[model samples]
Target chain A: MIKVENLRKEFPLGRTLQKELATKEKIAVAVDNISFQCQPGRIFSLLGPNGAGKTTTMRMLSTIFKPTSGNIEIAGINAVTNSRDARRKIGFLTGSTGLYARLTPNELIKYFADLYEVSDADFKIRKEKLFDLLDMNDFQNKRIGKLSTGMKQKVSICRTMIHDPEVIVFDEPTSGLDVITAENIISLIRDCKNDGKTVIFSSHIMSEVDLLCDDMAIVHKGKLLYNGTMENFRSNQQESSLTAEFIRIIHESNAATV
Target chain B: MILKIFLKELKDTLRDKRTLIMMVVIPVLVFPIVLNLFVTVSSSFEKDAAMQRVKIGFVGDAQSPVIAGFLEMPAAMGKKDLIPYPNEKALLQDVKNDSLQMGIIVPDNYQEKMDSMEAVTCEVYYDATDLGIKDRAKSYMEYVEKSARDKRYKSMNLDETKFQVILTNYNNTASDKEMIGKLAGGILPYIFIAFGFIGCMYPAIDLFTGEKERGTIETLLTTPVSRLQILIGKMCVVALSGLLAATCALVGLYLSIEVFNLVDNEEILSIVRGILTPSFIIMLFLLLFPLTVFFAGVMIPIAVYAKSFKEAQSIITPLNIVMVLPAMIGLLPGIELNYMTACIPVINVVLATKELIAGTLEPVLLLLSFGIMVTLAMIAVFVSYRHFGKETNIVM
Candidate 1:
C-alpha cells in the first residue's frame, strides 16, 4: 500500500548578485496540497499533461526527492524518515532512467538484485520468470547499448520487478515506445495488480489510464482536480469520452483560477 | 554490498577503451618510446658538439715565430679553420655575425712589447650566449697565453716551470651514476604524482557524472544502499585505478632507463637497484595510497556537481595543472624533506620520494608526511560524502 498526504515541493530559483540583497527569493511550487492512496491489488493512475507535477510527486514517493511538507508512507514505512527501508519496499521506474550500456541485461538485473539483497535462489527464480514473461531470453546476454529501444525497455521492466517490491511506481514508462511495447507494459501493470501489488503510474495518455488504472486522479497546475474510481468517473461522464471529461475538468480549473 | 558495487564498476572500467588507454597502454608503451627517442637525439647532439669545427678569426699578423708555430701545431690541424682579417674591427664583425667562433687581436706592438719586458694584452672575443663558441674561444686564449709565456722564457733562457707559481686545473670528477641519480631525482616525483592524479580523473568523471548523464543515477538512488556505501564503492575503484597509474609510471620509467641503457654505468645501476628494494616499493605504495584517495575525493565532488560529462571534464581539467605545479617543487635543488615540508601535500610526497630514492630518507619525516596525507585524504572523503548525501547533488 502507498499513501501520500498534502505532498508539496518548492524549488528556489538562483539569485543574481546585483539583486541578491534587494529582491526576495523566488520559488516555483511544483506540487501543492495533493493527497492520494493506492491499495494493494489495485492500479492507481496520476493523470496529468506536461509540467503537471506528476514526475515530482513520483520522485517524492520514491524517496529520490524530499517533499517540502508532506507525509509519504510506502508499505507501512514512512518514506522521509526511514528512506532506506521504504526504498526496499518500493520499485521505481521511469522512461528516462537507463541501464549501464556496457553491462548485459543478465548482469544488469543481477546487479539490482544484489543491491536489494535478494538471495541467490530467489534472484534466479525471479530472473527466469521475468525473462520468460518479457520474452527477453534471445538478447539477455547482449550489451544494453546494442539493444533496440523495445528490447531495452523489456530489460528495464525485468530489472524494476526483480526484487518484487510491494509498491511499484512507473513515471511515464512507455512514453516513446512502440505500440507493441507499450501494450506489453500495460499487461505488466495488470499483472502487478493481479499479484496484489500496489501500482501507481503517471501518464498523459488517457487510453493507458483507461486500460490499466482502477482508481485515478486528475492533476493540473500542482493541484488535484478530481479523484475517484475509474468506474465512477466513466459513469459520471454521462456518455462523454474520457478525453472530453478531462478537457471539461481542465477548463473548469482554468476558469476558477481566472 | 559495497564490494558488489565495486565489482560492477570495475567491470565497466575494464571494458572502457578510454580507461584502458589511460590506465594501461600509454603508461606501458608511450614512456619507453619517448625516453628512447630523447636519449638517442641528445647523445648524438653531445657527440657533434664535442667534435665541433671552430672558425678562428685573426686581426693582425703573428708577432713572434713561436706563437705562429704554436698556431700551426699538428693538434690544431683539420680541427681549426683560420681566417685572416685586415683589422680588429673586421674580426669583430665576423664574430658578431657568428661566422667566426672566436676572434683574436694580436697587438700591433706584439714583438716590441716582449723585447721591452712589458705586458701586452691581446683581446679575444666570442658570443657569450653561444656556449660552444665561448668554450672554444676560451681554450684558444689559454693556448695564446702559453705560447707567449714559452716565447719569453726561451728568449731569456729562464726555466718556465721554476719561475711559475703552482699551476692548477679544475674539472668535474663525479661518476656518471651519481649524476644520473641527481637528474632523475629532480624529475620522477612530478611524473608519478601527475600520473596518479590523472588516473583518478577519468574514473571519477565516469563514475560520478556518467551516472547522471546516462540517467542511471535515478535508478541507483532508488536502491536501498546508503549514500556512504555508494561513495565507498565508487571511490574504491577510483583509488585503485589511481594507484595503478602511479605504478605504471614508476615501472615505465624503470623499464625505459633499463631498455635504452640510458643510465648505463654499473655504479648508477647498483644505486638504482638499491633504491628499488622491497622496502622502497612498499614505501612508494604507502605514500601513493592516500594521494590516490585524495585525487579520488577531489575529483568526485566536482564531477558529481557537473550536469554533463563534458562539463565535468572542463571543471576537472584545471586540476591537472594545480596538481602538477606543486609536485614540480621537488625539482628545485635546495628543497628537501623536513618537519615543515612534510606537512605539505604533493610537495611532501615528492621530497620524500626523492630522498628515499637518493638514500637520504628520514624515517620520522616519512611518517609525518604519511600522516599529513592521510589526514587530508580523510577530509576530502568526508566532503565528498557530504556532497553525496544531498539529494540534489545525486539526482541531477
Candidate 2:
C-alpha cells in the first residue's frame, strides 16, 4: 500500500542573485495540500488536467523529487526519507522513455534486472514472460536506438515490471502511443492490478482513466477536487463526459480557491 | 549490484565501435605521425643551406692578410661560405636591412689586438629578434675566435694540440644530436604524462558523468548497493580502459621510434625495457587512479547538475585543456618537484611519471602520492553520492 499526506510543492520564481534580491512577483504551487491512499491489490489513478500536479505528486512518491511539505510511504517504507528502501519496493516507469538508446532491448532488461539483483531463475523466467506477453522477442535483439517508439514503450514497460515490486507507478504510460499500442498498455495495467499489486498511474486521458481506475482523485492546481469511484464521480457532475466534468470541476475549484 | 550496472556499461561501451576506435586507434597512431614529422622537419632544417651559409658584407680589405685571413678561416672550416662586402659600415648596414644572414663589423684596430694579447671584441652584429640569424652570428663569432687563436699559436711556434688548448678551448665532447634529443626528451615526458592523464580523464568523466547524463544514475541508485561499490565497479572499468589507452600510446611511441628512426641518439629497442620499469607501472597505477577519481568526483557533480549529455560535455571540455597544459610543464628543464607537488593534483602525477621515466622514484614519494590520490578518490566518490541524493530540481 502507498500513502501520501498533505503533499505540497511550491517553486520559487528566481534563481539568479539579482532576481533573488528582488521580491518574487509570483509563486507557483505545483502540488497543494492533498492526500490519498492506495490499498493493496487495487488500482488508483490521479486524473487531472495539464499543470494539475498529478505528475509532481507521483514524482514525490517515486522519490525522484521531494515535496515541500508532505510525507509519503510506499509499501510501509518512508518514500520521503527512506527513499532507497521505498525505491526497492516500487517499479517506476515514466511515459517519456527511461530507455537507454544504445542498448538492445534484451540488454536493457537484464541491466535493470542486475541493478535490482533479481535471482537468476526469477530473472530468466520474468524476462521470458515479459517478452512473450509484450512480444518483445521480435526486436529484442535490436538496439533500442533503432527501435520504433512503440517498441521502445514496450521495453520501458518491461523495465517497470522487471523487479516485480509490491508497488508500481506509471506516469502517463500510454499518452504518446498509437491506438493499438495504447490498448496493449491498458491491458498490461489491468494484468498488473489482477496480479495483486498496488498500481497507481497519472493520466490526463479521461476515458482510459475512467475505464481502468478502480478508485481515483480529480486534482486541479495541486488540490484534490474529488476522490472516489467512477460511479461516485459521475453522480456528482452533470457534464456529459469525464473530461467535461474535469473541465467544469476545475473552473468551479479555481473560483472557490481564489 | 553496482557490478551489474558496471558490467552492463562495459558490455554496452565495448560495442560502441566509434568510441572504442577513438579511445584506441587515435592515440596509438598519434605518436608515429608526431614523431615522424619532428624527425623530417629537423633533419631537413639542419642540412638546408640557410642553416649553414652566412653572407657577410665586408668593407675591410681582402688583399691585406689580416682581413682576408679572417674571412677565409670560416670558409675553410666548412661552417660558413662568407659573402664579402665593400666595407665595415656597408656590412653593418646590409645586416641591419636583413640582406646579410650574418654581419661582421671587423674592427678598424683588427691588426693591433692580435699583437697585444688583448681580446678584440669583433662587434658581431645581427638582429637578436631573428633566432636563425642570432644562432648563425654566434657560430660565425666562434669561427673567428678559432682563426685568431690558430694564428697566435703558430706565431709562438707551438704544435696544434698544445696551441689549440692554450689559445682556444671548445667542448670536444659536445654531441649535437644528443643535445637536441635531450631537449626533445624533456618535452616528451610532459606530453606522455599529460596525454596519458588526459586519456584517463575522458573515460573517467565519461563513465561517471556520461552515465549520469544517460539517465542511468536514477536506475542504478534505486538498487540496494553502496555508493562506494558503485564507484569502484565503474572506476575499475574506466581505469582498465584508460590504462589500455596509455599502454597503446606507449607502444605507439616505441613503434614510432623504431619505424621512423626518431631520436637516432640511441636504439629504442635496446633501452625500451630499462625505460618501462616497475617504477613506471607503480607510478601510473598509483598516480592515474587517484587523478581519475579526483576528476571523477569533480566531474560527476557538474554532470549531475546538467539536464543533458551535451551540457555535461560542455562543462568537461575545458578540463582537457587544464590537464594537458600542466602535464606540459615537464617540457621546461629541471622543474623541481617535491611532496608539495603531491598536494597539487595534476602536477604531482606528471612529476611522478618523470621521476619514474628518469628512474629515480623514491618509495616514500610513491606511497605519499598514491595515498593522497586514493584518499581524494574516496572523498570524491562520497561527494558524488551526496550529489545524487540531494538537489531534487536537477535531473539525472
Candidate 3:
C-alpha cells in the first residue's frame, strides 16, 4: 500500500539577482496539498491533463523527488526518512526513462537484480519468467540499441518488474507506443493488480484510464478535483461518456480557478 | 553493488569503439609512429646542417699570404666556399642579399697590425634572424680566431704549443642517461597528465551526462542504491581508466625512445635502466594514483552538470588546457620541488615527478605532495557525492 498526505511541491522560477532582491520570491507549485491512498490488489490512476502535477506527485511517491511539505508512506515505511528502504518496496517507471543502449536485456536485467540484492537463484527464476511473459527470449541477447521500439518496451517492462516491489508507479508508460504495445502494457498492469501489488499510474487518455483503473483521481492545476472508486465516478457522471465527464470536470476546475 | 555498476561501466566502455581507439590504439600504436617521425625529422635536419657548405665572403685584398693560407686549411673552414669581395660595403651587400651566408670585413691594416705586433679587429657580419646562417657564421668566426692566433705565433718566432697559456678548467661530466632523464622529466609529466585527463573525460561524460541525455538516469535513480554508492562506482571506473591511460602513455614514450635508438651508447642505456629503479617505478604509481583520483573527482560533477556529450566535451576540453598550463611549470628553468610548492596540486605533482625521474626525490616533499593531493581528491569526491544527491542535476 502507498499513502500520501498533504503532498505539495514547489519549483522556484529562475530570476536575476536584482529582480530576486527587489520582488517577492516566485514559485510555481507543482503539487498542492493533495492526499490519496492506493490499496493492494487494485490499479489506482492519477488522471490529469498536461502540466497538471501528476508526474511530480508520482515522482515524490517514488522517492525520486522530496516533497516540499508532505508525508509518503510506502509499504508502511516513511519514504523520505528511509528512502533507500522505501525504494526497495517500489518500482518507478516513466515514459522517458530508457534502457542502456549497449547492454543486452540479459546483462541489463542481471545488473539491476544485483543492485537490488536479489540472489542468483531467485534472479535466474525471475529472469526466466519475465522473459517468457514478455516474449523477449528470441532477442534477449541482442543489444538494446539494435532492438525495435516495441522490443525495447518489452525489455523495459521486464526490467521494471524484476525486483517484484509491492507498489509500482508508472507515469505515462504508453504515451508514444503503438496500439499493440500499449495493450501489452495495460495487460501487464492488470497482471500486477492480480498479483496483489499496489499499482499507481498516471495518464491523460480517459479511455485508457476507464479501461484499467479500479480507483481513480482527477487532478488539474495541482489540485485534486475528484478522488473515488471508478464505479462512483461513472455513477456520478451526468454525461453519456467518460471522456465527456473528464472534460466537464476540467472545465469546471478551470472556471472555478478563474 | 558498487562493483556491479563499475563492472557494467567497464564492459560498456571497453566495448565502445571510441574508447578503445582513444585509450588503447592511440597510445599503443599512434604514439610510437609519431615519436619515430619526430626523431627522424630532427636528426635528418641535424645531418643536413652539418654537411651543408657555408658561403663566406671576404672583403678587401684576399691576396695576402696570411689570409690565403688561413682560408686554404680545411680545419679553419670546414666545407666552406670562400668568395672575394672588392670592399667591405660589397661584402655587406652580398650578406644582406642572402647570396652569402657570412661576410668578413678584414681591417685594411690587419697585415700591418700583425707585422707591427698590434691589436686588430676583423668584423664578422651575419643575419641573426636566420638560425642556419647564424650558427655557421659563429663556427667560421671561431676557426678564424684560432688561425689568426697561430699566424701571430709564427710571426713572433714562437712555438704555438709552448707559448699557450697553462690553465686547467673545470667541466661537467654528467652522463647521457642523467641528461636524458632530466630532459624527459621536464617534458613527460605534462604529457602523462594530458593522457590521464583524456582517459577520464569520455567515460566521465558518458556515465554521468550521457545517461541523462539518453534518459537512463531516472531508472538508475529509482533503484535501491544510495547516491553515494552510485558516485563511488562511477568514480572508480573513471579513475581506473585514467590510471591505465597514464601508464599506457608512459609505456608508449619509453618504447618509442628505445625504438628510435635515441641513445646509441650501451653504457647510456644501462645507466637509464639503473635510474628507472624499482623504487622509481613505485613512486611514479604512487604519484599518479592521487592525480587520477583527483581527475575523476573533478570530472564527475562537471560532467553531471552537462546536458549532452557534445556539451560535456566543450566544458571538459578547456579543462585539459587549464591542467596542462600548470603542469608545464615543471618545464620552466629553476623550478624545483620544495616544502612550499609541494602544497600546490598540479604543479606539485609535476615537480615531484620531475624530481623522482631525475633520481633526486625528497621523501618528505613527496609525502607532503601526496597528502595534499589526496585531501584535494577527497574534497572533489565529496562534491561529486553531493552533486549526485541532487535530483535536479540528474533529472535535468
Candidate 4:
C-alpha cells in the first residue's frame, strides 16, 4: 500500500534578472496539498495534464526527490525516514525516459537487478521471463541507441519491474508509445493488478485510466480537484470522458480569480 | 553488490566511443605530439644557429704572430676558415661583398693586453638584427677573452706542468648534461601528470554525469540499494576511469620521453624510472581519487538537475574551461613542484609526480604530500554524500 498526505512541493524559480535586481527570492509551487492512497491489489491513476503534480508526486515516492510538506508510507514504512526501504518496495517508470544508449538491453536490466541485490538465480529466471514475455529477442543484444522507441520502452518497463516491488509507479507510461507497445504496457499494468500488486499510474489519456484504473485522482495545477473510483470521478462531473472532466475542473479552478 | 555495480559501470564505460577517445586516446597521443614538436623545433633552431656558415679574413701582415694566430681562428670555428687579406680596406670590402661574416681586424697590439696584464676589447661587427650570426660572433669573442685570461695566469706562474696540475686539481663534480637531464625528467613528470588530470576529467564526468544526463541515473537510484552502495558503485566506476585514463597518458608520456633523445643528455633516465614505482603510482592514483569522487559528486547529480541534453551541455562546457587552464599553470616550463603544493588536489599530484620522477625529493615530503591529498579526498567524498543524501538530491 502507498499513501501520500497533504503533499506540497515549492520549487525555487531561478531569480530572474528583474527579481534579482529587485529584493526578494522568487519561487513557483509545483505541487500543493495533494492527498491520496493506493490500497493493496488495486490500480490507482493520479490523472493530470502536463506540469500537473503527477511526476513530482511520483518523484517524491521514488525518493529521487522529497516533497516540501508531506507524510508518505509505502507498505507501512515511512518514506521520509526510511526511503531506501521504501525504494525497495516500489518500482518507478517514467515513460519518456531513455535507457543507457551504450548498454545492451540485457546488460542494462541486469545492472538494476544487481543494484537491488536480487539473488543471482532469481535474477536470471526473471530476466529470461521478461525477455520471453516482452518478446525482446531480436534487439535484446543491441545497444539501446539502436533500438526502436517501442523496443526501448519495452526494455525500460522490464528494467523498472525487475526488482518486483510491492507498489509500481508508472508516470506517463504510454506518453509516446505506439498503439501496440502502449497496449502491451496497459495489459502489463492489468496483469500486475490481477496478481494482487499495487500499481499507481499517472496519465492525461483518460481511456487508459478508464480501462485500467479502479481508483483515480484528478490533479490540476498542483491541487487535487477530485479523487474516487474512475467510474465515480467521471459520473460526478457528469462528463462522459476523463479529458472533458479534466477540462471542466481546470476551467472551474481558473474561475477562482486571484 | 558494489563490485557488481562497478563491473556494470566498467562495461558501460567500455561501450561508449566518445568516452573511449577522451579517456584513452588523447592522453596517449597528445603529449607525444606536443613534446616531440617542442623538442624538434627547439633543437633545429639551436642547430641552425650553431651551423650557419661564416668566413673571416684577417687584415694584417703575415709577419705579425698575433695576426697570424687570428687568421687560424676561422678554421677552429669550423663553419668558416679565415682568409688572409692585404689591408683593412680589402677586409672591409670582403665584409661588404658578403664573402665573409666579418673580417677579424686583430691589430699589432692583439697580444699587448696579456703582456701588460690589461683588459683589451675585441670588436665583432655583425648585423644587429641577424641574431644567429650575432650569437656566434658573441660566443667566439667570449672564447677569446677566456683564453686571454688563462694565458695571463700561465705567464705569471710560468710553469706549464704546474698549470696543468692546478686545472685538474680543482674539485668540481657538476655535469651540465646530468643536471639538465634531471631537471628535464623532473619537469617532464609534471607534464605527464598534467595530461593524467586533463585526460581523466571528461571521462570522470561522463562516467557520472553522462549516466545522469542519459537518464540512467533515475533507474539506478530507484534500485533497492543503500546510498553508500550507490556512491561506491558510481565512485568506483569514475575513479577507475580516471586511473585508467591516467595510465594510458602515462604510457604515452613515457614513450614520448623515450623518443625525446635530447633528454638523454640530461642524465635523467635513472630518476625517470621512479615513475614506475608502485608507491609513486599508488600515491598519484590516490591523489586523483578524491578529485574524481568530487567531480562525480559534483557533476553527476548536477547533470541530473538539467531538464534536457542541451541544458546539460551548457552546464558542462564551462567546467572544461575551469579545469584545463589551472592545470596548465604547473605544467608550463620552470615551475617548481614543492612540498607545500602537495596540499592542492590536481596541482599537488602534478608537483609530487614531478618530484618523484626527478628523484630529487625528501621521502618525508612525499608521505606528507599524499597524506594531505588522501585526507582531503575523504572530506570531498563526505561533502558529496552530504549533498547526495539531501532530500533534494539536486544540490539546490
Model 4 complex DockQ against the native: 0.65
Q: Tens digits of per-residue lDDT for model 3 on A59-85? A: 899888999998999999999889899
DockQ of all predictions against the true structure, Cα-based = 0.84, 0.48, 0.78, 0.65
The positional error of residue B334 in candidate 4, measured at the CA in angstroms, is 9.6
TM-score of each: 0.92, 0.86, 0.93, 0.82
Order of quality (lDDT): 1, 3, 2, 4
Between prediction 1 and prediction 2, which has the larger DockQ? 1
lDDT scores in order: 0.85, 0.71, 0.84, 0.71
Fnat of all models, as shown:
0.87, 0.36, 0.80, 0.78
Best of the candidates, TM-score: 3
Q: What is the TM-score of chain A in candidate 2?
A: 0.92
Better of 1 and 2 by TM-score: 1
Q: Count of backbone clashes for each model?
A: 0, 4, 0, 1
Between candidates 3 and 4, which one is better according to TM-score? 3
Off by over 4 Å in 4: A13-27, B30-47, B55-70, B74-76, B81-122, B125-135, B143-182, B253-351, B358-360, B390-396
Task: Please give the lDDT score at residue B247 for candidate 1.
Answer: 84
